[model samples]
Target chain A: MSFEKVEHALHKRRKSRNIGLGAVLIGFVALVFVLTIAKVVDEGDAQRAEQALRINPPKASE
Target chain B: MSDASLNTTTQDGDAGFGDFFALLKPRVMSLVVFTALVGLLAAPVPVNPIVAFASILFIAVGGGASGALNMWWDADIDRIMKRTQSRPIPAGRLSEGDALGLGATLSVFAVVMLFLASNIVAAGLLAFTIFFYVVIYTMWLKRWTPQNIVIGGAAGAFPPMIGWAVATGGISIESVLMFTIVFMWTPPHFWALALFMKSDYRDAGVPMLTVTHGRTSTRKHILVYTLLLAPIAIGTAFTSIGGPVYLAAAVVLNALFIKGAITIWRRDETQAEADGYRTEKRFFALSLVYLFAHFLAILAEAGLGQFGLGGWA
Candidate 1:
């Protein structure tokens, strides 16, 4: 037995479109991940500095 | 896979990826990206590189969303105008619904993302820009008045301010000056194109200056705007973002720009037709370079500022 395959312009364009959309979605996820990490790290550093300042008040305040 | 499936796809008029992208008006998006980046970098406050990149991305997406929305609303006139007939909506490559959906979704997405990545000020400006471009300009002013682009130009001018806000978290004189330069440049740039593409606005009934005011008046308008633009652009040189390098570039660019405008102002229809609006065409081309070089000079000044050699000490 033999099998036949078919191709069309529409299929090629549709495939490309799917791939493009997939790439964009993946990029968006990665960007959001990085942004979240940056924000969390920033907040953590700020909190740590605040705690340190409380434990050792500034000489100016004294 | 099947003949029936192929028939259905063709019948449904499904678009390719490029068709979807075309709805965003990538050329205009590029201008948005450049101006916004310049604005952000020129501000005194420093931004985290990651945050800056994300903010700029959202701003560009917002601008593209507005472009898509504009296409959705102007599909009819777009089909009539020779210049816009090939655009996605008008060309039947994408439906108006597709543009509307994409624009609205991206508008919301960009605003929310910008707020998360930067401050509220930048996000607010982005929201306003999308509204101004889509509702105020496209839906309201474009067809209602000959001075459409004059007011509509504000929509394009906001990016730099938004960019500045992203960095500084507030508005300032420098950002306003940056905004003013683009605001003033738009009239002459667009009117020059209107001069040569004479019948487009008329045929589409959009009330462009050239259509409603006549070519002579359009020429005069271009000259007036160009004259007004020179002082603002040159005046930017004295601002915080401006330096000696910027001043030099502004002086030379403004001089050439004004001369081009004068040559355009002096022409009659007969002369214009004889040379096929060559002067007008050149003026239009120069307008693009004029705006780009101005922002580029500002960027260069900002770069030099890092080395302590930029602004006047």
Candidate 2:
């Protein structure tokens, strides 16, 4: 293959890879966001559950 | 064209500390650290803050070690693929021998120190994580089958469980849920990237979804995984570390994730090509946030618990 043809092919390959990487990076950000939100909310509820159990403990069987 | 000529040419490049560090794949390391920290904090058992810090640091080092080993093994394909070509070994910044040495040293140090500082179970889990990532994922499964990431993702999912083990000295339902969230999330997250980067895997001779199964099958797989992931992500709300706040976050984030997956599924290849890969791009980005938000919500719930508020046990 000619030098120019090889260069063109390399360029095309890089472009495709770039698109794929971009997609991957974006997906990573989305997953991080979802996880972060869940982390924050779960922590909150855990605190409340701790309090609720302390204040209004479960009843024992008669 | 000889091997000597190729080696000589490759050896001419610079290989500094920065280059050596690049082999660790810091982006992936950060995710490992964050999830592991969440697991440590969310556990019902109390751990000394100093010990907790050390455990997390060791876990991060172990994760980095795994990445280096992966780079060492995949150097050949990394050289061929555009995306991985700039990695330390592939870019000729570091030799494969050096990567292997560094990865091996860190792996041993991380495991031994984790065992001393925490417990045997956590140490064993860390060791298995390194072995799984290096042996099962990188060397064995990667080239052999398209299901590589799906199964090998267990290595990535182990950190949080390891962290929980460190805190509690054993696995629990909460830790398992943490593991499950990442396990189910991996396929769709990776497949989205594979969809747009199909040619790289093709060039590298790796059997990724886009290469082995075709783009249509890959897209359908992403949607299917996302469908399963949405429920699991929401189900964490019912656990000991879960409550109303987490449930709310799960509902919203999962809705967005499902919508993104549907958008990806509905788009034809021609449209994807014409739009310069927008749908796949959006879904991939959302997947990152999807994971981070889940962990951050857990942290938030934990913090609220300290103040005698929120609804978790």
Candidate 3:
């Protein structure tokens, strides 16, 4: 007896949909990671700038 | 039925990824993306590149969510209308329940992500835009009133405003003008479409201007709205966002748009039917170009200003 399974078009379509969804999810995760990194870096820069101003405050009348 | 036959039947009704994507109304989403991007770019405040990109994506997803909700709500009419007959719900590739779930989920996701990426104001505007499009426009205004498109157009006009908020964290005259430009442009644009897309809205039983009022009234309405749109489109030139490039483009485009409206207004049914709505169709095509070119000119002006030549001092 042959032991082969027939692949239906429905299976292919479902598979494609699953892959598309998987790709979207992965892409979303990567985006969030990048966004978080960018936000953290931005806040850090702002904090550093604030500190620098405190340490070497500008003269009132230049 | 044999298994093979059953499989064939099942596959025929099965939806692919693209079918699901169609639920988002990608074409409309393109307009949302472009206008929103322009708003973000043209703002006086400089957004971090990453924040800008993320905010735009969330705005687009929010726009798409509303579209899906619209498709869900209007599935019946969509099935009747020739233009929208091939949408996923009408085509039986996706169910209304599927659309509802996707739309609801994405709406929340987009709003929350936008808040995290940008500020509360931008996120709030995005949320309000979604609510306006899905509930106010789709559920209440669309089928109930002839003024549907006029009011519903507000939902579309919000994206650029949201984009500006992303950069500036507040609304300004520039953003308001951007909003008004789109708000005024929508009626004439859609009315011209209704002129050419004869009997589609009528057959669908949607209270489009053509259905509620006769074709003659719709034509007259288009002329009036186009006339109103002209000053706003041209006047935006003097705003902080506008410059010489925008002014020149606006002058030419508005002249052409008004000329098209007059031609449309003058024509009777016999003349339009004889030429298969050539003038109306041409007018419709020009309307699309008119809006895009105006926005492009604004973008061009902003770009030039970056290099010390954009807006008038």
DockQ of the two-chain complex in candidate 1: 0.49
**Share of native interface contacts recovered by each model:** 0.42, 0.00, 0.61
Ranking by TM-score: 3, 1, 2
- For B147-225, candidate 1 gives per-residue lDDT tens digits of 8899999999999999999999999999999999999999999999988998898998988988887888988898899
lDDT, candidate 2, at B16:
43
* Candidate 3 Cα misplacement greater than 4 A, ranges: B1-5, B10-13
Best by DockQ: 3
Poorest lDDT segment (10 consecutive residues) of candidate 3 chain B: B4-13
Query: Could you say which candidate leads in lDDT?
Result: 3
| lDDT (Cα, tens digit) per residue for candidate 1, span A5-25 | 566676777787899899999
lDDT of 3 at B7: 54
CAPRI accuracy category, model 1: medium
For each candidate, how many residue pairs have backbone atoms clashing (under 3 Å)?
Answer: 0, 72, 1
Off by over 4 Å in 1: A48-62, B1-13
Please state what fraction of the native interface contacts candidate 3 reproduces. 0.61
User: Order the candidates by lDDT, highest first — what do you get?
Assistant: 3, 1, 2
- Ranking of all candidate structures by their DockQ, best first: 3, 1, 2
